[model samples]
Target chain A: MVLQAAIEKWSGKIAEVTIGAANAAGVIKVGGQETLPFLFSEGKIPNAPRVAFEVWDVHPEDWPPELAAAWGENLKDPFAWAEACVNKYQAQALCLRLQGAHPDYGNRSAADEAKLAAGLAQKFGLPMIVIGCGDNELDNAMLPAVSEALNGRQCLIGSAAQDNYKTLTAACLADGHSIIAESPIDINIAKQLNILISDMGLPLERIVIDPTTGALGYGLEYAYSIMERARLAALSGDKTVASPFICFVGHEVWKTKEAKVSPEQGVIWEAMTAAALLQAGADILVMRHPAAIEKVKQHIENLMGK
Target chain B: MFIIGELINGMYSNIAAAIKEKDKAAIQKCALEQIKCGADALDINCGPASKQPVVDIQWLVEAVREVTDKTLCLDSSKPQVIESGLKAAGSGSIINSTTADPEKLGLLIPLAKKYNAGLIGLTISAKGIPQNRDQRLELAATIVSACADQDFSTENLYLDPIVMPVNVAQTQMRDILESIREFKIISEPSPKTVVGLSNVSQGTSARNLINRTFLTMAVAFGLDAAILDPLDKDLVDALITAELILNKNIYCDSYLEAYRRK
Candidate 1:
């Protein structure tokens, strides 16, 4: 018997989302694949998955030493750090995490965080991803002001969760910015957050999903599988889960013992985690370490055969 | 699933009594209740019990209009009766349904085009319901080609492969399921698939269990629409979950609520 082709005749395509202000110099567009990633013969993948290097407002105390040394003293200044990421490392876009506002960190005010984000957006002039401190109360408190400061600048504001999305959702909607909805590893919860945010009137085209992946060898397959399943659902025409996914590739990679404890495995561990997600249907990859970012960029270019 | 609520038919005791008495309130109540429970559309049938199915179908359409504007699936063997219901339906209706018989298709296909309503074609004919997948496929291909000849959009053509009760015809049930998958390859733009879902469990003691289970399996095999009881909570839940697992809807914590609301 002849082998049957595995290609699916999908009626739905992933909703295309472009994260960059209308006035920004450039935009990074993701999603909008009519087939599973790299299934060239069956469907259309309009754009390649993008890689954005991360630069924190507060120096990350827990960052792996290899990751820190890769950036050197430029890490002290967020502007210089982001500049190097874009200009020197040829990073496509930039992600600025306002870690300083967390109570345990600098305990900085929301206004100060907003100012820092706005300054970076002005200096970078690229697709800027402005995210919160990863604290529910703090993120809810800080993201609104940051959203207001970058009101028309068109930064992608993060992370509305099930329990606390109202403030951030309202801020993004009022400010004309996009949002990233974060959920636990559960596929259902990931879909729920997207629905909830869209219910508050953010377009599905303006939202991206992050189904919280862990580092390689640490529940990575579970997270990767959820992303794979979600993408399959999107391709099969489920509008509720069809938004592009944005994975915090570096956050999870840096958290691993392989990346932090073992110097030999640091860069490759990040690359492997990211490369695997790219295959599993990630649309936007957010990372640290310029060396790893360079490797992922090369992999993505090769996949797109650019 | 594109669910057309089946509670408005005169075969049901409540609906039969309401149709005989011309009780507009009862008709409207049933329509609203089904819509509230998540029916995508409604099937309006004045079954053989009605002395005047033509007028009764018209009355059912207008009565449903007062309560909700959801699509009405006009059910009758007579084209005139379907036309009566269509005239009163105002807008957005489906002709449910026609056999592969050329004469029936000759009358109903034009009526479907005239009103711009959707068309459902059964895999049975004037001869009778098919005995196997090949027979069913032959009848279905005839309906699809006939619909295409009329310039009707094939996607709007819903093919119903007759589901017999499992108690008497267990083997036929497997053929019925296989035919749903085959119906997709019959034409360029395949006709949308539906079944009168409650038929699978008609004589069985486990009516709801059999209906929900069978409907879920049918959905997996590419059945996109059904004429079933949306008011049955368990049946609707099964349909929603099947669509979810099949990746037809996005998963959410409150996805059931979300699906119903959509």
Candidate 2:
């Protein structure tokens, strides 16, 4: 008897979302696949997963030596760091985190954060994902200002949770930008937050799922499974959970001991985490470390057969 | 679930008046409201009062189609009335149904194929509504076989197990639910299952509560579609939550609002 491979067909396609405005130097489009990640023979995977270098508005106070060494003094200024990410590292996109606005950090005002975001966007027209400080109250106050300053640029802004999504969702809707819905590694919460954000009048096409990343050996499996399940649901014609995934690879990977061993080890660890997530259907990877970004980009190129 | 809004039927006084007076505004308003409330399709029926049943159905179909291109289920017992609506409905419509009787199947299945529309088969025949799950399954099998003999794909066929009014036939409610589950296995790729959801609560007090509860239960039993009042916010919410819990839809905090928006 002859055996043939059984092909699986899906009824739904992931909604394709474009980051950055029409005139931007590079507008990264993600999530127009009708099949599971990397199953090229099964269906179309229109866009290769994107790798974005993570930058912070404020200098790091508790950076591991290995991670900090990658940027050196450039980290002291947000512009220099962003310039390096664009010019030197050849970043496809930049993920700017306004960490200074955190009350525990520099406690910068909303105006200062908005100014930084507008300046960086002006300097480089790459697709941008502007993330607020982890503080929910502070973020609600700060992100709207940033969203206005980057109005019509179509930047992706967020970390809007279930409890506090109204402000950011409205901001994104007004500014014509996209949002990143954060869900704390729970699939239901991830979907629920997407619904809540969308209910506030932001279109689903303008929302991305941030299923809360977990680095290698640090609940990575849990994060991976959630993403896999969500992707499967999306492909199975569940429109409610069909947005592309944005995994904060740098944030989660850098915090792990496995990634803090050495600069080389940290680079490999971040790359490994990113590579794993790409297979599990991560459309946007917000990563740190140039070497890791390059490595994952190459891995994505290979997997996508480009 | 594929929710077919059941409000545009002329059985309602407002719709009956609209049909008699040829009020296009009333029909269009009903169509738009149902679509706004998250109806995947609208069931168009002239009810029983129309002297010109065929013309009334065509008018309803045209008026509803003018507002939105959402699928219209052309509903009538007479094949000519359904055919008149189907002619005006254009593509992607559904024939609201046929019985298991060979003659009804013979007429409607060909019409369904000619119009490239879905056909709903009620698992009841000239013998009347099935008494039990097994009888319903047997009729469903007969309909499935007849469709096969005519070379009509079962994928486009929706099998309804004839939901009876709980006040009148309370014992058959469980049987209907069971029949819905069993209908899938009658074929390899099963015909989709639907029900006239309001039938379960007909003439009962707390109709909304009973309708929603039963609709949720039917969904759990793999009911694929329903003909119900989408305007009932609570019932729609219950159906949304049930599908979410079953993992048929991804859950969100404002899932009720989200389902409507979708």
Candidate 3:
């Protein structure tokens, strides 16, 4: 009560923020809260988990062949590929995905993507997230299958949005899984989705908000500001917007040239890619390269301690 | 909706004297009243009371514990008082708070782990409450980092960004609201965001009316827990109604039932 009274006494006057740490296995602990984001002083924040590497179903022909070479033969099979990502790469969690299911991509069926999600979860022991390409219909159809397949494992379904929250949220509610509520780039819209989900009688703790991200050099700061603003609302007790957040790090990471292109064409950008994400308030980073994962994990780990 | 009773603290002279006299009946009465009225927890603030704050805290905690199984919200500025409260509580308590104080950051953190107690981290630095959102977040960041460093579970800490009065600055509520949202996004899955529901409506006409309005808005900002009087029908009614409007409770059934009883 003294802390609260003093904090309330000093609310707008203080100027320091804290970010928390990850565990040995990389699950970010809830402690070590302090004045700076993720620093170990202002308060207590505990375990910090490692990053979740993004894996796609449907061989990413769009991805450079060099990228495909990293996974070897596992790239061809979603289930095998996810297993390999976890076992070989020491990935803390897997973002087994249905990127190709988008109409513009593979245009796969909900059942098909759901089956992939089921297979991946069954085959991989790692905590996983099932991501769908931004197609409302396909996501609605497929997310439930993913939810049903994972059941009590507490998987995070790809998303629910203003366009298609009803179906996706229902699946998450039914399966005892969590859902990510994404908004294009507005704090108001982000808050609205959270309200919508709460309106549906789902637990706020079970949902993670993704204030949609933009690539670096392409309005990422706006996303950062929005995340910061949203967090402020949560701290102030806005139940709608206070849930934990999720960021599509790989999606934004890959879209940035610094991550996709090499140093010969430009300055060494891989380092920048990892650094940029850490700076952007990313909690669960979904990355691509083994090097980036290790780099980000290490950077995050360093921030966790003295 | 966690209601931490604000009574039995030195902020009120009668409460201070009762504890000094070791008036178990007086302290027990507050604790039981809160629990019977559905208080999830009771906040015992030992403000500027006894010279032996820690001893007083221990006695009050033990006294309250004897009377009710309801959890204690150990509130005190003195680290020793907090430590004594924790020691007295033994287990399952809520640290009234640890602030952005550098030395205090790591202080109550261990107590929380030791007692498995939930905590409240106020967003204020040694310089005191920030005047703006940036300053407030800075303090919040520091508090969250302290928790992270200690390997304290984020969920265990309730980060209160410190809501100031709307009369002094109308945007004060808005600023706190924004900070609550951002704190959650950044803190993510750690530190439950909360607020002192009474602060926002202070000095406003029809205080209860203002409090209810502010509570609804705060809930929209993603409020998970609030510290307020469970006895206030208007405040309680507002929470139930707000929950329904926000779709927290279905079809307003809970709201209607709550209203009927009131």
Tell me, by TM-score, which candidate is best: 2
Identify the CAPRI category of the predicted complex in candidate 1. Answer: acceptable
Question: What digit string (tens of lDDT, one per residue) describes model 1 on residues B149-248?
Answer: 8888888899999999999789998899999999999987778999998889988899999999999999999998999999899999989999889866
* Local lDDT at B162 for model 3: 89
- The residue-by-residue lDDT of candidate 2 on A42-108, one tens digit each, is 9999999999888999998788989888899999999999999988988889999999998777999
lDDT of 2 by residue, B1-262 (tens): 8999999988999999999999999999999999999899999999989999999899898888789999999999999999999999997899989999999999999999999999999998999889998999999999999999999999999999999999999988899999999999999778999999998888998899999999999999999999999999999888999998897766655667666765
lDDT of 3 by residue, A49-110 (tens): 34777888787777654355566787777767777777777777877678878876778876
Clash-forming residue pairs, model 1: none
DockQ of 1: 0.44
Best by lDDT: 2
- Every model's DockQ: 0.44, 0.56, 0.04
Model 2: residue B53 alpha-carbon error in angstroms: 2.0
Candidate 3, residue A100: CA error in Å? 3.0
Model 3, B1-262: lDDT tens digits are 6667777777788788797777888888888876666567888877784788878888888989898777888888777788899888878888878888988887788878888998898998788778888988888888888888898878788989887777877766678889888888667665688888788777878778887788888888888888887777777777777766775432322334432321
Which candidate leads the pack in DockQ? 2
Docking class of 2: medium
Question: Rank by DockQ, descending?
Answer: 2, 1, 3
Q: Chain B of candidate 1 versus the native chain B: what TM-score?
A: 0.97
